[model samples]
Target: MLGRMGRPGLIGLAARTAVVAGTATAVSGGIASHQANKANQAAEAQAWEAQQQQAAMNAAAAQAVAAQQAAAPAPQATAGGGSDLMAQLNQLAQLHAQGILSDEEFAAGKAKLLA
Candidate 1:
């Protein structure tokens, strides 16, 4: 029954403190790193979802445009006045001159008008 003291030595206390501080620092750093990784993953997932939503919207808009074009009514022509036909031909000629329509396209338009 021969023991030293009520408290540990100064060097023993310093060693213990260092061990505790180091362990605390290491655990806190690990937790912070984990949280950052989780946040990064969440942000990336949000960005990916946004991109998918944008793509879907773009597709829907394109479909809407196609549908609108398909549902549009053709111009009505005057039977004997020939005014409407001339206007249509003039429009085709203008489109061809603007390079919006090719030579074959202009020919097709002219044929359709005459027919």
Candidate 2:
């Protein structure tokens, strides 16, 4: 071994080949692991974004429903053919002012009250 310098012997050659193969395997494994971690992180981020979007859409839908509910007409105090005609007309006017009733509906109610 002390006088061998021109080329590696069979044992040395085998040792070198093993070292190179081990290093290549380790490096390739490390690269594969890194790429897998990156892919997993990207997938998680996309899922999080999708969840946020769904939550926003749900919130908007809830707000619209709340607005609709707020705009709906309240139940009348008395049934049909009741004696409080003035009260009914006042209620219709209030609903119109609050934008709950359309213009045509307001006119129809007033005409019905007068009739």
Candidate 3:
């Protein structure tokens, strides 16, 4: 029994091994691809969230600038308006020191005043 059909048995064993190896490779490849896709999606979501946060910050800065401009006194026609602009700048600085304005807000306000 040990010597009978030795060659045929070896061939059958080799075929079975190949089938098992192919199946394992396909399953592993599928799992790896799925994981890669999930990681890509997570990264994209994180990037999108960061972009939205940045946009919100930009809009807030613009709003703060507009607020500062509105708060400033308009230039007078009769005399020098330098003091009026300087007073607006001082008020903005005080607001920032009191923590009423964030750093972004303070910068925006200062930019508007200088403009």
Best by lDDT: 3
Ranking by TM-score: 2, 3, 1
TM value for model 2: 0.63
Candidate 1 wrong stretches, greater than 4 Å = 1-6, 74-115
- Predicted model with the maximum TM-score: 2
Runs in model 2 with CA error above 4 Å? 76-115
What are the Cα lDDT values of the candidates? 0.77, 0.77, 0.80
lDDT of 3 by residue, 17-114 (tens): 99999999999999999999999999999999999998887677667757756775665544886787787778889877876667887888689668
Model 2 lDDT tens row, 10-32: 99999999999999999999999
What TM-score, computed on C-alpha atoms, does each candidate reach?
0.60, 0.63, 0.62
Full candidate order by lDDT, most accurate first? 3, 1, 2
The superposed Cα distance between candidate 2 and the true structure at residue 111, in angstroms, equals 35
> What lDDT is reached at residue 101 by model 2?
61
